[model samples]
Target chain A: MSAATEAPLLELDGLVTEFRTGGAWHAALRGVSFALARNETLALVGESGCGKSVTALSIMGLLPPANSRIAAGRIRFAGRDLVGLSEEAMRKLRGNEISMIFQEPMTSLNPVLTVGFQVAESLRYHRGMEGQAARRAALELLDQVKIPAAAQRFDDYPHQFSGGMRQRVMIAMALACRPKLLLADEPTTALDVTIQAQVLALLAELKSAYGMAMIFITHNLGVVASIADRVAVMYAGAIVETAAVDELFARPTHPYTEALLRTIPRVDEDSAGLAAIPGQVPPLSAMPPGCRFAPRCALREAECEATDPALAPLPAAADHRVRCRVRAPATAAPRHA
Target chain B: MPEPMLEVAGLRKFFEVKRGFPRATTVTVRALDGISFTVGAGQSFGLVGESGCGKSTAGRAVLRLIEPDEGRVAFKGEDVLAAGKERLRALRRKMQIVFQDPYASLNPRRMIGKALTEPMRVHGVGAPGERVARAELLLAEVGLPKNAMTRYPHEFSGGQRQRIGIARALTLEPELIVADEPVSALDVSIQSQILLLLQGLQERRRLSFIFISHDLGVVRYFCQSMAVMYLGRIVETGPIPAIFKEPLHPYTKMLRDASPVPDPTRKVAMLRIEGEVPSAVNPPAGCHFHTRCPHAMEICRKAYPEWTPLGDGRGVACHLHKV
Candidate 1:
């Protein structure tokens, strides 16, 4: 649990993003921060509207320039500050050094264009390959993603492929440039369970083979357990806890993390009953005065309502951090540790 | 032994798809090809499958919401498929259904009270004066606030709206409720709450449920018995705990194994079975799953496997248990 001296492949420090709605600016991401090492997968998990996708979009520079702004923060990728990077610079880095795959590939992809052409476009633009050279690379990319009859299907349009195959094409495009970091936002959620397993396994294999670090965003905890090296639990626009996949599941420090774990019905074994969190996520526009999760948290006390809690590292395990005053006491170290 | 509240036999529903647009040849897509299972008086039966596996179709077909080409659906030993319009309409009140999407199921513009009372008004269950009081009572029964009746569907969260849907189902006092992926759309916390509410309602009302879902965990917890469908056929049907402990069919085993267990350290044996489901229009000649089964043999491709019973209502359709 000691601090890692080595530099991470990507890091975000005190990132705050706001959106202008109805002429009023509202903060959607409040002081969100995390880091990912090369070849390591950090699963960003949260409920709907928890800013999981927004964080990914913020990093991709896909957020609306007119309404949303990164008010304060540092986004350092490979030791380079990327907060205020010019659009042209970001374009050069995006898809070449970093690529993103969304939840529904069918919608994300251009329907008219052949998937092969779409996948090859990244190669031609990023690596400057031409004609046959690009086509060959695209076919190889398709093969790597395990698309059956890759060569034969190259000329087929997006509609010709199925949901699972379309996702593979999306992955082929994302990995075309061999990006150092891949931001996958619920990439497997739309597929069937068996197909989801296939995609997750493919992603795991691809990550290792290419030595690509990834920020895998998903709402399913079971997906996080197998696919992630570590996990960052986000709630109400900020991370409530960050721990190794095993530790977070084993001993969740934050009340929200604990409740989230208890809510999942078990397939591996019998569960007495699911313990649901009492209330809904507070509306973002009219948030509570103190801890964002205080209203729903069973462990919430008077002091928790009076002051907002900041994410703090537990002394016994420097890597395990929790943003909870009542549930995680600073003085008392983790009992198991 | 107590007679099951609902019974289905050799149910089939097929849709015709036109391939190659201009010179299109119509092909039969066998959505629900002769699948059958039962639910006890107050026990839940889960129907689990992927997108095109026909679980939803089966639910709709059993309820007579969708007319099936062939099948025998018996509720309380009465023929459902052969029932006349008046009889079928009367039977509908006894067998209701809850849809998956809470938002889409409810009328957004109408108040929740009116939405709940409309069924009773059509069935002529109660006096006009009693419908309003009944709506409020049903709302509270599903654990929603009394004021929920006056609010529109948009005002409620996904979880609350689901509760409203459940309440609407209860308004008819149906003996069996077909809940199609009822909790799949909500957050995990909200999903549990709905599951618990259903569990409590089942205990209190002695209501049987046809629980349909892609999520094995939720189904395993909610349904006492289950049927795993593959390519429109029930590959396996048995008690949920028994199936979970030891899956007999390769397809069911693959589904169980593929389900992501929340435990990080539990590494399930990775089966080599691959490929998405083939089009149902022209399903593999014999066993529909033979194309993707890890232990598929030559005989599997040559002939369709017969349903083999393993006693205690546990059965499977596969060549592996041909003895």
Candidate 2:
């Protein structure tokens, strides 16, 4: 691969995104960093208010302008830092080089406009395609997302579509430009299980066909297991663990990850009883001083409460990194040594 | 076995919705079409289905919160639908429901203590002082601190509010509780906490629960037996283990295959059926699932299949299983 191809398609270096609450800025994303390669799917797994959605908003430059801003760090997409880019410059990249789909398609889509017109708007805006060309492209995109009878339903409004069909329309709109990167935030969370399976399958097929890198943000571990190539488990505004999907599921290093895995009731196996983590995710404004998870972590140490732990790579596998004082110590010797 | 705690026979609920333009037509939405199930004393029976499949409707109908249009609901062999106003009011003390959204179910302005004690007060179960004591005890039982009683609903987190909801349900010492998606709104860690709490309450109180949920994993863990509904009809009904291991109805099989398991090795099954669930108002003729069933036959489209008993509390309503 050439150097350009070898480089990560998107990289976040110590990204800190903050939102102003009660007249004081509180960090929603605290020193979060990750790299996404071409055509790879990275799942951002976390509970609600864990800053997964905030991370996607940060990348898309969709964060609220009045109260929220990138406090520090860089968000580099294809060798360009998105943080300092002008709105005009960012607008050109958005929906062309990168696109996003939200959880509630009903809220995301324009109610008054026809589904076809909404989809074609993206093509006309990004690619400057007009008239017949844009319409044809939009129809094809709808068909690609497997919206049945795309031509017949093209003129139908958003309300005409069901929950699953509306989500298909949202996917159609996001994939219209064949963007290099796609940010899907709980795209199938609103749909039924059967519909969710179809959507997940469609996303997987479309990702490979388009060869697009994707950041899939969801709280569903089952979804993360199915769709993600690599997984970044977040908690209290930080990435607690990141590793290959198989390795992460097999050997979850972080205490939070381990506890979360045990908590989910599996359909495949008859779980005796789920082990519930006692404390909830701390509020962002009242975050703990040291390790954010130390208060709820089972393997907490005296030092854990005194100092925050850096995300350090495990000796067993360099790619499998974890943020913990006790588990993955910074001075741990490499396995090869 | 001892007489079942709750027996529902041909329970039906239909809603007439007005649609169209100037020449409007009354459409009959068959939310619960002749669904029947029994919950033995202290047994957890789950009603599982996708959205609009009528699981929630079934839960509501059994409690008579929404009066059913037809069929019989018997509590301990007592005809619930036929009960007089005073008789029904007494019966209400034994039957209660916990809604899905804890925030919406609770009154934001009312203190948690008031919410918990009000049901007891209405039923005239205890004196004012005793009701307050019981409210605090219930709060402690649900794992909430005593201080939580004085706080408003908004003061607590989603999980804490759910605990309050559960505590409120227990204020009347109901024998059968219709927990409609109680843990669905909670986070994974918090979901487990709530599940364990419910499980503990079930064991200690020996309460029977009619658990309603869309998540197969949650249903499997919480329910001993379950009925998989599709467009207001039970497609498959049996022990959770049997049905999960060998699903008879194609709809049940699809639901089982479609549910994403936490394990990465087991790839989510490619759903053979396509298209969203048909509208309940105008469900397809014959088997409602025929429109999506991969193995759908001419007979399936012409007439609904009869329930086929498989012995040992197992049954299926599908042409494929009709022997």
lDDT of 1 by residue, A208-285 (tens): 999999999999999898899999999989998999998888888999988988898888888877898988888778
**TM-score of predicted structure 2, chain A:** 0.96
Pairs that collide, model 1: none
lDDT of 1: 0.90
Cα error, candidate 2, residue B167 (Å): 0.7
The candidate that wins on lDDT is: 2
Tell me the deviation in Å of residue A252 in model 2: 0.8
True contacts kept of each: 0.61, 0.72
Model 2, span A48-160: residue lDDT tens = 99999999999999998999999999999999899989999989988889999999999999999999999999899988999999999999988988888999999999998
* Residue A175 miss distance in model 1 (angstroms): 0.7
